[model samples]
Target: MSDQRESIRSNAKYLRNVRPIDPEEICEYVAGNPHPAVVRQQLREEAADLRLIEQDDGTFVPADDEPVSPRRGPVERFPAEYERRLEDLLVERYGPNWEDGASGDLLRSTVRRFKADYLDGRPVEYNDDVAAGYAIYHLPGYYAAIQYALDDLADRGLLDRTLRVLDLGAGVGGPALGLCDYLPDDALLEYHAVEPSAAADVLKDLLAETGRNTHPTIHRTTAEAFDPSEAVSGDGSSDGFDPTAPDDGFDLVLACNVLSELDDPVDVMQSYLETLAPKGTFLAMAPADKNTSVQLREVERELEEERLWDRDAVDFETSAAGDAERYRRGEVTVYGPTVRLWPGETPSDRGWSFDVRPDLDVPAVQRRLDENAPDDGEHAPGEFVNVDVQFSYSQLRLDGRRRIDMALETNEWAKMAEMERHVTERIDLVAAKLSRSLSGGDGNGGRGSGRSNPLFKISDGSEDTDHYAVVTTETALNRPLLEAGYGDVCSFEGILALWNDDEEAYNLVVDEETIVDRIT
Candidate 1:
């Protein structure tokens, strides 16, 4: 092993610069290997200073002397059934005093905001392509674990029959809608989405327009304050909740990308896990971020005490590199895009495939060339490649029209276009070898050229290297590809497009393991 270390380091570039990793490929990697030493090291480094904050709800908040402002709102005036449950939640959490006029007005306003922003007609500014794209782009890889775990449950006949699904912190309803798209039409799914933001309204309207509202129940309630009873009427049935069917506890509970936000995710999960029926599936997904790691650890700890269902590691889905970076930076303002779960075994199900158009998915690869290089304005210190996941493969024939329509309604397309351009410009750099080869000029200047490949250089704030990386003799190549497939696969051709093709420079690497470790 020691002998192989030198080779691993020497040939790391060659080994790392592999093609895009598939969902199945990642599944196989986890299936084959246990946690690696580096992973443990990274986890420790990432978690070293971690201190568990004993939140009122039992979820650990990061140690911050600055108090987390209490979430304030009026008592919601949902339909009678939803109202009753909302009242019960108010009493249980905030004490009975929270059920009156001012509180009701506050809740009403918040719900109205949720309906307006996320329902069908309201509006808020969450439609930024960079934000949405970042979320959509990376969610699949992490979603893949949920898919695999759900499939395993289905294979076990656990998800058979019409199942009720509840998506907590359902951001733009990505996983909720993604699951809706993934499930069979006749699957008899009663989707009850709990999103407290205006974005929830946008998602609600989206589902309704797409005819997915046939059996949907949307509540503009935060996960902490969201009342399941509100989703299920007093008589244990769904009312104006779109589906308007019986509102028993959900058969499958999906909390994706939101756990990291809770003061006590376990308390939140515990609050809902009991709502699941025997043999029910509880799935949670989160970015393979520090918050997720802590949340998962906490959940595992809690489950150990409960002696509930077993857990199996699964594949890592894909999403935007920038989004993942935001998560690492704890800058992702929303959740639900990443997922975490309980009760569900490692899912083996192949979730929905991306259906973005080919042209849209395949962006032009650009290399920011150094003017003084062998080839003026030709050689770059680095390369930037973008793959439009939505455009990559539309085999599923998804009507991005609805999403696009929503995008247009939100008017985020222009912003998305601008973001794409901005990202491209940011990642464009001088490829060390390309600059050297360019200094040799055209094909006429062969080897033995005096020019040298540039080493690491800082990126202008304009680009988000959240996706790109530096390659050197000891640089690991596959890391990026791992990231790409996990979110957006950067093709070899895309790399070549940015290369000078002169010097022996390191190509991109897709480290599926590392990528999976981040968002799953």
Candidate 2:
């Protein structure tokens, strides 16, 4: 069997650059004349290793070398195919009309119980009912949120075409499915998911809907227990694997919505960073709520600019030499969404920042579940709908790449660290717009008036306190603050910086005199 597999691989390698390698045609050349179906299955297993893409005609072709391009527009809706797939899974487990009866009661109570636990900062176990409930309530928003977070990497051509990815605590395949969809059709993906729950079942079913070139493996284990070196190694063992090898690491490591659930998030994050390729990215995300978002930033700051050591290289007996050797390993840096624009400064503010995108169109399953809620004095109109796309994400890299890398000159722009001195004075400043409009009819706190001023959270990575940019008057010159997307850096000229005693933050007032331009 091994000899036949090797013979098939040899033939495909020779024909890959020449033309599409058909499994049936290659089967004729194998030692024992294995069946074409067996050859096809063998090729599917080796596609990632051989860098081949399986086609619809049961043939294999070389994957394109170009990186996946950044998606240009907002993720308006979750794909219908995945929606139907989830419904199918629900039907298989619970009967048809799963939205009502005993199944409905179980799912509704499961969602409410977990939601309450999350609000109170308690961990919720991922049993079968909880997994299905999570899928119906959280899948659409999470699926939409990840693509937006990935744009911070894809925009700079950082995402690769031939990709190896590790997804830690990949609950119910929200981020996994989002990433598969984010890549172009020609891109080849080797996805390894670390999830130890019933959610893995749902994830496995949903991943089947991904493109043919995407090869997925679900490791039914926790993030801490899963060995990264063994997973990425060729022979599935870590005995002779080199942790420092360039090609033996994942191109992207995702820890979305999982850090807040870990006991030691910083140490776990550092461990994963050592397994990242030279130019790979580690994207950590959390819910937009205050506690989780703040905790995510806390983990990011704890690991930022800190050198990580190869655990095997450390000789505990020789402390001095070990410390000196470990210092040369690597440093973790924040890549984007949040900026470290100033050369020698880091924000010490509350760091409660989040991005709000256009709400996703509600999925059919969510609507069905919500509409069928029993009127036992507990059901709200839209209790089960999870369409809001609000999330907080931090992109970390060991390659020292930042989405916005620019030095702010003190003579030209006012540093956020020195905002106190410039308060009550019209000043020029540069900042990344971190949040969407926080005023008007939006649920976010602000005036309830229909004609309220547009307010945005802005950061320049040098503040010890929170800062906001308020557009009091709209004009052609200052309208960019309202038009620019989240994480966009805008230049504010002749803007009045005032201290808001009520909010305990600086509000940069942009009126007719202010010229706000988005720096591309």
Best by lDDT: 2
Q: Clashing pairs in model 2?
A: none
- TM-score of decoy 2: 0.94
TM-score of each: 0.35, 0.94
- Model 1 sits at a Cα RMSD from the real structure of 27.4
Question: lDDT per residue, candidate 1, 203-287, as tens digits?
Answer: 5544653322135668877899976767653223333443212234466777776665677877787667656544355666544
User: Best-fitting candidate, measured by TM-score?
Assistant: 2
lDDT of 2 by residue, 345-421 (tens): 99988888888889988899999899999998989899999899999999998877788888888988999999999
RMSD of each: 27.4, 3.1
| Global lDDT scores for all candidate models | 0.35, 0.87
How does candidate 1 fare on TM-score?
A: 0.35
- In model 1, how large is the Cα lDDT of residue 204? 55
